[model samples]
Target: MDTMRDRFAPVVSRLLDEDPRVAVVLAEIGKDGFAEAMRRHPERVINVGIREQLLVGAAAGLALTGLRPIVHTFASFLVERPFEQVKLDFGHQNTGAVLVSAAASFDWPAGGYTHMAPGDVALLDTLDGWTVHVPGHPDEAETLLRRAVAAGDDKVYVRLSVQANRQGRAVDGERFLTVREGRSGVVVAVGPVLDAVLAATEGLDLTVLYATTVRPFDTAGLRRAVQGADTDVVLVEPYLTGTSTAAVSEALAEVPHRVLGLGVGRRELRRYGTVEEHVAAHGLDARSLRERIGGFVGAGRASVRA
Candidate 1:
């Protein structure tokens, strides 16, 4: 599978070379991937060392100067650590930027709690008018990034995870794409969690929906899909659990529905080794998802064994 960062590097290089108004701000990360690109367009690329706050601030400044800025860094540093900068510098000032984040959730669990950012999406939800894209595959990432860059002055958050699904590209719209069809219920898989969700629901009578563009969420699409189904929706996100609960609730307000939010558990497990271990610890593995989802739709246990 092609890595998201690897896919991003070339697109950014192309953007820099083609558009003089495009600038990239990095914070001691992605230097290896963007080494040549940076060297080629030294004036357009800026690295602010380890200072995430200054990194975002500089990006905001660049945006103010009529240049589109793509701010790249780990999810922890880009969204969590320098949240104030993101909220005030960009959100408050109304400056637009493509906030590209890598190492989503517990991708680098060995890096510990400080490096994990399960709350990044929830935090971004607090700010208004931010388009959040959680691409499930590298191809989807490329498509989303290109669209975000083309939609200049729109504050977009492109969340990239190390994990990927079984290669599926998203459609050219802000709507959920139906991957599998069934009458039991609807399973909405966000970003890289598609493969896991697919495995979990294998052989089950359920509908699976995929979304790369999460924010500006496809509420209309969701409502249309759930129109004649069981109205049992299970949202599987890669970030904080229940991140889209409110949106789902609003979308299906008039219909009688039962929704189960699944993602990295709310509690900090505080123990980690491999990515799979962290995912299991958070009850995000295929088995756990199957059981929990089964319970939600009345196919298994009375309650999920989390």
Candidate 2:
């Protein structure tokens, strides 16, 4: 049950160990874990104090200087505290730096609202050159990280949860993982909600798509996948509707699709609970998903009888 951080550490460790040109930037919160991983390859670790803005700016500077830099920090701090810096310094300049956003969404309920970043994905997607990825499981996280690092020039934002061992089928070659067949009437989900969707529709004909890469979406693949099945499509995510879900809907305009966005509403998060509680409260749980699917398919009576 390795967390996204755990999955990322070894891949990053190997990258640093193999390539001297790659540098790892650690924010105040993620420094310990990143530092521990980079200990065996000490020369590559760049510990930047508590300044999220400066951390990203420094990573941009390093990238400009031809060193590949991976900036790590909590999602809220990474997006909010240094938004302008990220937009202008990295996004504008098209720096090849990668941002590994840890504790995205409600992953750290103990950290409270300030630490909870429900809008990070929304903010990042507006940027022109940046590619945003929200991996549902550890395997997807690792694959996305590898792709981000290998891209070399495109700015990448990776939203990762603190939870461990999420279930997702690995994608072939790319970070864009797919579960079920690439059939029509696909239900696209990000984060652990994919597991809920899979469990909810155990024997159904619906295609479940695990969108590991959120921004810079796989449009061609998506189009091909949904071309042959039912016209109805659903998109499930753990962030606000305007972010990933909106983007997906806009892309699927040719088809009859409905996006079932699940996340904290427009209001700020004011509750106290674990990630599971927050997800369930917002109707992102397995039971809730089953209810939604039943309603969507108009098979409530059949599901109830079974």
Candidate 3:
């Protein structure tokens, strides 16, 4: 049950030590792990306490000065609260930055709705040229973080969750990787939800696709995967429901297809206990996923056997 956050600290410290142009901005989230990075490069590593707005604004300022800044905080604090700063300071300014977020979606359910950020991706979609990466495991997250730092002047958002798949897989960030092949439908599992999606579609006849990068979606890959198949695309994301519905529709506009989007449902305002409990409450558990996916692929009765 180790998290991407555990792997993130050491990587950030190493980056800070290696690159003088790279800076890390903290808003009171992972101060303990990044403490050494701050100690090594006090000029580059910055902490603004709990002020998320200034946290984002400071990163933007650093970007304006030809320095690449990696900002970290909770999803709610990083995106939902300082949206204007993200929109204007980064988007409007046309400055590039790597925004790293922990406790994405409902990872911190005990923190309540104030901490959960189901709509962060949707909000970022409203902006332009922002690359979003939802790494499934620590290895994937590390790859994406390195890429983001190497990618100069390109806005990147890395969403990290506590849940992880059993193993780590190398992510290319440009296309979807096929995990399993079937004849029924194509189930695209985004980031941390790969394990749950794998469990749900264990015995079903469906092609499973895993994506670490959601924005700049691989339309070509998806189109090729569903070339002669039943055009049934099911996108299972960790963010809000239907976050990629528009992109999926745009990608498959030439073909006739039915799409089903699944993630954190927005209807419920109440708490659903622990992270596992919240996942089940949103009908994202293996059983619920089996029922929904099976129903979507026309395997209603057969899905129950799993």
Candidate 4:
């Protein structure tokens, strides 16, 4: 299976050929993949080298001209580094651009903390009118990319990652897809972490909801999934832990519920290790997840602390 970032280049290239208003601005990340597209439409494919701030600023400028601009770079550089530019140039100015990011969470641990961005989704959550997509597979990434490209002039962030699931799930507009059904509780798995979530959740009598388009939060789907069942929700995200806990709370505000948000911890891992090591250390592997999730749901605890 190809990584989400691998599929992104071809998808954007096709978008460039199909739509004249579409443009991609990069910060020297994934430049080689877009070489053919660059040759075809040099003006539309802008590479701003390592200038992360300029990458966003230029994309916003292009948006002001009525062209739908797409910005690409690592998650840290794309969202965290030029966050002020993303806010001022795009949000404050009422401009729109598709910000695509690679290396989700800790894809390249050797690149150091500067390149890792497990908090990108949480950071974007602070902003308004930003649509976020975390596809579990490359095919889903392409589907979401096309949707974002034609999704009007609203801000969109398609998070591409080196990590991916073994298979792809269906893209159902902007709602979560129900992968399995049960009565005990609901486990919401976001992006590439779906496979592990499924593995950990097997035979647990818990409903599994796969999410690709997470910005809108799929409140309706979430509410529906928990109806007449235990209202305990375990959110397994590829990014920071507890990032979507608030959204879950809001969705089930009227109903009695307990939520356990599991993902990358806030504490920085000082040692540079492999992604597998990071996963184990963070307790995100199937064994750890099963232990944590099973304990949480099996304890019969009526409430989860915020």
User: lDDT of each prediction vs. the true structure?
Assistant: 0.89, 0.74, 0.90, 0.92
Question: TM per model?
Answer: 0.95, 0.87, 0.96, 0.97
lDDT of 3 by residue, 252-279 (tens): 9999888999998987658558888888
Over the stretch 1-36, how does candidate 2's per-residue lDDT look in tens digits?
788888776788888878777789887776656666
Candidate 2 total steric clashes = 1
Cα error, candidate 3, residue 158 (Å): 0.2
What's model 1's overall lDDT?
0.89
In model 3, the worst 10-residue window by lDDT is 297-306
In angstroms, how far off is 199's CA in candidate 2? 1.3
Q: Report how far residue 28 has shifted in candidate 2, in Å.
A: 1.6
Task: State in Å the error of residue 46, model 2.
Answer: 1.6
Best model per TM-score: 4
Residue 177's C-alpha lDDT in candidate 2?
A: 49
Between prediction 3 and prediction 4, the one with superior TM-score is: 4
Question: How does model 3 score by TM-score?
Answer: 0.96
lDDT of 3 at 268: 61
* Model 3 regions lying over 4 Å from their true place: 299-306
